[model samples]
Target chain A: MKQFFIFVKKEFFHIWRDRRTLLILFGMPIMQVMIFGFALTNEVKNSKIGILDLSKDEATAKLSERISASQYFDLVENLKSSSDIDASFRKGDTKMVIIFPEHFRESLLHSNSVQVQLIADASDPNTATTLINYASAIINDYQDELMGETKLPYTITTQTRMLYNPQQKGAYNFVPGVMAMILMLVCTMMTSIAIVKEKETGTMEVLLVSPLKPIMVILAKAVPYLLLSIVNIISILLLSVYVLDVPIAGSLALLMFTSILFIITSLSLGLLISSFTASQQTAMLISLMGLFMPTLLFSGFMFPIENMPIPMQVISNLVPAKWYYYIVKSVMIKGLGIEAIWREVLILTGMTVFLLTVSIKKYNVRLA
Target chain B: MTDEKVITAKALTKKFADFIAVNAISFEVSKGEIFGFLGANGAGKTTAMRMLCGLSLPTSGEATVAGFDVYKESEKIKKNIGYMSQKFSLYEDLTVKENMRFYGGIYGLTEKRIKEKSQQVLADLHMEAEQNKLVKSLPLGWKQKLAFSVAIFHEPAIVFLDEPTGGVDPVTRREFWEMIYQAAQNGTTVFVTTHYMDEAEYCNRVSIMVDGRIEALDTPTNLKKQFNTASMDEVFLQLARKAVRQAD
Candidate 1:
């Protein structure tokens, strides 16, 4: 244990002394996080929606069918009570909610007046805004049909309300996306370079021949990167909340827990890359070309995964960053708890475990 | 120097698939002896050194370092031996003192010991004024000498050098041998592999490997008499002519 600390300290010194590595380790994450959070735009399709129909009338059913039949919306669930609106949003079961009055058909016949409400979780303002527009258009089409013969016009006033994000800030959607991309890029590229630097300079052979345990050597090498990645996470989160003005609506502790898990997954991927690469350049190249593109493309950060081809959609499931992006978005934007993001958390954990197993198997701790 | 053996091997072998890299080679090194391992490129000198250093597993036969079996007690063997390679060793980005303290610390030395030993190492090299400089800023000769000094800093029972002085001035190489002689006199067994025949003349006993086997091993004078040559170079050439493995 004493030796392990000493080794970790040495590893830290290596990181501190090299200017280029120091820049990539600390500078790149902060720059990318800020750049991406403020400037990136988001677009999404196939957003799931829920319907709360107190009347259960033919008119309510027909509107729900019209919304679901469109390519932009997927009617996923029926909310049994008004209370279920918050629960459905928190569980990520729906992106938007449509509520009908108790006697929609009766009220229209008696007074030629009724009301309909569309509530959206505006943490993702683009998707929320688009869904509201689509649903309002459908309700207006229904209202136009009823106005064909009546002089009163039987008005259906559509009201749209945003939950969680009242101001509909743009940071809500892409902050989590930026966090996933930065973590994946910085953690992976830094660690693989650190490990491969030893191999390139021949320090690894010296370390391997020492009395220190090979496992200890590997752990010592990874510990510094892990801690630095945590620091990056804290910086990104602070910037999002303070500078970008996006609040953490879920449990802060759970948010950190999931971020650390994702960091470990990226570090293990770095280790696997180091095992196959003999030079620091190769490690850095693989980290960039292999990890960065997939993360940006498949994590739904830069491109909407839903709008992709079927083969791409299937392939996106294998990207670890995709799940991490989902977890962060659910926790930070939708204000969801572990009950909603637990499956994503589990998937990240499983990827970390598998990556660690394969990397340890491939990593040559000896000179052979 | 006592005659107690610090390393023993009995037909230790290593095979890479169909190729036999080290085939049933056996040797022993007594304490305080400067044993030179001489070979042409691809002659399996490094493969044998790796097995003895507890870095590679032998396919057959047996070996021991510092009274511990190479197979079952490699960790212990590593604790008892120091290794240096010609390709590279110390962290170039770290200061000379930092590199010393780092290696010393990982060897389980205390803070005070690391400080004191680092000071002593710097003073011995007449480099006390340059201790704070990064190793990359130093010249190649000084770096090699510092690497050799740091490798044996833990006072391990045996120090293994895989061509420690590959490219350097002849004067610096001579100075490097003086350091090895001083260490051997202080009761540390030195096991070195080298391409320089003159360096082999300085070893107390030299082993010539050709094609995965030790073709000849004896005192320099004895080897000269056995090979019927005037110097170690002709002795190497006469034996190396038998090698069939192509050098990379």
Candidate 2:
């Protein structure tokens, strides 16, 4: 509509005129991608590795306990059989699958040796290799302790099998996380603050009193943000692929489609925050505290969700950013298709719809 | 013209939970009269105006603006009315011309009409040379005038001004009243709410609200005579002291 265009044009003027906004919109995404991609991480903590204990003996039980107890890895899934490891790896749920052969205690006592196979989901080669080394060292320590006491000779072997990411580039992990964080900051935080600024300046009343419908006003406000978020996505993708050398394994179209859903989810969240806040300062604080902290702490962008406490893992389910991070990981790093990520897409879409509905209901044309 | 009422209300009310913001009250305004809405800080002047402007729903009662029902035909009412708030509502980041262009565009003004009207308004304000300047750079008086002009740019049947001259000098306020008088002379009804008692003298009729109800409604001369006061200020003080609710 002509009125919608006029509203959008006015919004553009507001955004363009503010230098701080221009800096935040364009500067922050690139800086976040480059800084997080190249600089932040090397130590792997809370790697989700599955454990399959074929021998229900004291030794394997002790081994599982010690592996999980170690600071480096969190034993996320306990597999029933060898058949489940491949599916778990493809799901990107588990980084490594440690399997103990049947009759390991008997075989170790009878032949002085036992075989243990370590299957690493090489999608993140760095993490996979580190997990294998940690597991191997733990086993060697246990074997050495046995040798220290008894005169009998015994040996344990660790076989490492790497999966999707053969190169173990650290950029793989950082790329997905940076994308999620930057999109969330730009879309959610920025939109909330912008809308609240109108409320602060008292221009929102004038807008509401205009002939333009409230829904149309909200749509026009969101359009510029949607376009800006897309631009941010493209810029992050370029930096990740070209500068950081992170590969895009899946279809770029599908990646973009998923990003659009995530952006909408974030925008709805921002609108919801704006509706609750009376001023720009309150909106900014709530967005940073509500969105930024949770996305950073619980979304598995900075830390693995499986490694978090049970309550935290449950809470992370409510954050749209967690699902977006998983989707990015599956499509970009694991090279998985839509069939593998349909549930995440559904969740993001559902969150978007729910947030948008609540915000629309909450957005009052009347001044409080 | 007095027989042709533009705004008619009967027992209009608004309640927020247990608290009644605007208790049952009613009044009527002529088609081209300047109606001054005066009240203490928490006297519910804004609440009543909000309901009438189609921005809020009343808990009970019926009202019509510009011949359209306030409840069901709010969109129609919106198209026929204009509003300006206490905080001057111009986009400070935008140039003077752009602000006019934007308001004109949203009010359904055609491109040529917008250009011509923008020019005419700028010339009328003697601000044609300052059209390209950002509104924030202008003085408070100019911003207030520009905001008022934009509100009635569409020539709505009624224009509601909420404390339009709050922080301006007396000379500017006088000039601003001249503009309102000119608009009313051209057959545009003005419904304005202000804290300043002197501005009430400029209105054709004035209503003073106290504690969610209109305590007095009459011409400024009659209000002064009835209260046994020499000035509108003394008359306001005598009525305002009876307020049951504290200023919010």
Candidate 3:
């Protein structure tokens, strides 16, 4: 045990002396969390909109005022003629144009409806689609206010309540996803590169011939990374709570335990890669392509797993990050306990054990 | 030491899938003797050395290092032997004293012992002033010497050196040999492999490996006399000329 501490200390010295590695280990998590928290978001806000109110009536003016009052749209301009819509879009001043036809209130009062044409720039289809929804929602609210006590014959009014995130903040979704990603990157990628580096430098042979057990050598390599991964988890969690205001609804201890399990899973994966790779470059390539790419695309971080193809959904089950992301969301956002996340915890534990067993077997076979 | 054998092997071999890296070859090294394992670049000297050091396993044969079985008691063998790989294996980012402490700690040396041993090692190399410098800042010869010193820091029964003086100048090579002789004189058996034929003459006994087998195992003078050559270099060329395996 004392010798193991010595080995871990040596490993830390390797990390400490290399300024670039230190930067990557500490700086990458903060940068990734900030990027996912602030930049890469699905929520639509402050969309620039143009209103062409040809009706010039009380009801149309009230609708325009309600849309502008909502946080979703900035209400960039009010155009006189319909021809001005093209210029607004061309100047990038408005993302959506709302045209209210003349006699809008008279038509709604007598017949029951009026034509409110919503034209949106489809150049960025996602933002355009979201903006159109926001505009329609604002107009619907305005109509509801206009219909004070008069109930429609058969109006299917739908009320949506964002369950976990009340305000529909993007940080709630990203905090967990970023945690999964940063843990995978720091533990799996960095550990594999460190082991392969020792092999490339011929130091692995010396370690192999030492009194230390092969298993202990592997543990010694992992211990420093494990500590660093914990530090990273803490940094990201602190950033999420303090900077991004993403809450941890479950027990913080349970969240940390799950993070530790995921980190070990990643470290075992790295050891497996290091067992087969002869150089640091090969280790890095395999970790990035085999681990990071799948974690990014298939882990349900940026995309929904259920929406994927059947084959992709099946493949996603094998990605540890996918399970970890779900677990993080359940614990931190959904406020679920161990009962809700036990299956994912088991799967991650199974992966860690499987990778560890396979890598140790590979190491032994190679040594023989 | 009364002809005590530190290493004993019979028909040791290593095969990589379809390829036989080390053919069944046998040799023995007495205590405190400088046993030279001379071969061309890919003559399987390293493969054979790795097996003896417990870093590799023999496919089919019986071998013992420091009186431990190569197959089952490899852990015991590991504790009793020191190895210096072909590439000087020291952490470039770590200072000389730090590398010493790391190696010593891994080999189960006590903290006080590591400190004393490190000071002694630095003093012997006349590097006491530079003990805090990173290994990358040192010259190649100095790094090589430091690597050798660290390899034997645990004072193991057998010290294995694989191409220890490959790229150093002649003077440095001679000085490195003097260190080897000093170690051998202190009753530490030195098992070394090298491509330098000139180093073969300094060994108490030299084994010339061709392809994957040791073609000749004798003193340098005897080898030259038997091959009817004036130097060990010509003797090696004559033997390597009839080799079948290409240098891998």
lDDT of each: 0.87, 0.88, 0.87
Off by over 4 Å in 3: A40-45, A48-172, B16-19
Query: Which candidate leads the pack in DockQ?
Result: 3
On residues A1-368, what C-alpha lDDT tens digit does candidate 3 reach at each position? 88899989989999999999899889999998887666523335788888889889988878788888888788889899988977888897577788888888788877776668888776554456567667778777767766775764222132332222233322237788888888898899899999999999999989988988888989999999999999999999998888877788998999999999999999999999999999989998999999999998888876767668899999999999999999999999889999999999999999999999999999888777
Task: List ranges where model 1 is wrong by over 4 Å.
Answer: A40-172, A364-368
Each model's iRMS = 1.6, 2.0, 0.9
Candidates' DockQ values? 0.61, 0.50, 0.72
Ranking of predictions according to TM-score: 3, 1, 2
- Model 2: residues with Cα > 4 Å off, grouped in runs: A40-172, A364-368
Residue-wise C-alpha lDDT for candidate 2, range A281-357, written one tens digit per residue:
88888888888999988777666676677998899999998999999999998899999999999999999999999
lDDT of 1 by residue, A1-368 (tens): 99899889988898888778678767877787677655532233577899999999998988888988987788899989999988899997588999998999999878888999999988767778868888999999988887886766688999889987776644336778777877887778888888888888888888889988767887898899889888988988888788866799998899999999999999899888988899988998899888889998888876678778899999999899999999999988789999998899999999999999988877654444
Docking class of 3: medium
Candidate 3 lDDT over B206-228, as tens digits, reads 99888889899998889989999
Best by lDDT: 2
Q: What does chain B score (TM) in every candidate?
A: 0.98, 0.98, 0.97
iRMS of candidate 2, Å: 2.0
Proportion of native contacts kept per candidate: 0.87, 0.80, 0.85
> How far is B190's C-alpha from truth in model 2 (Å)?
0.6
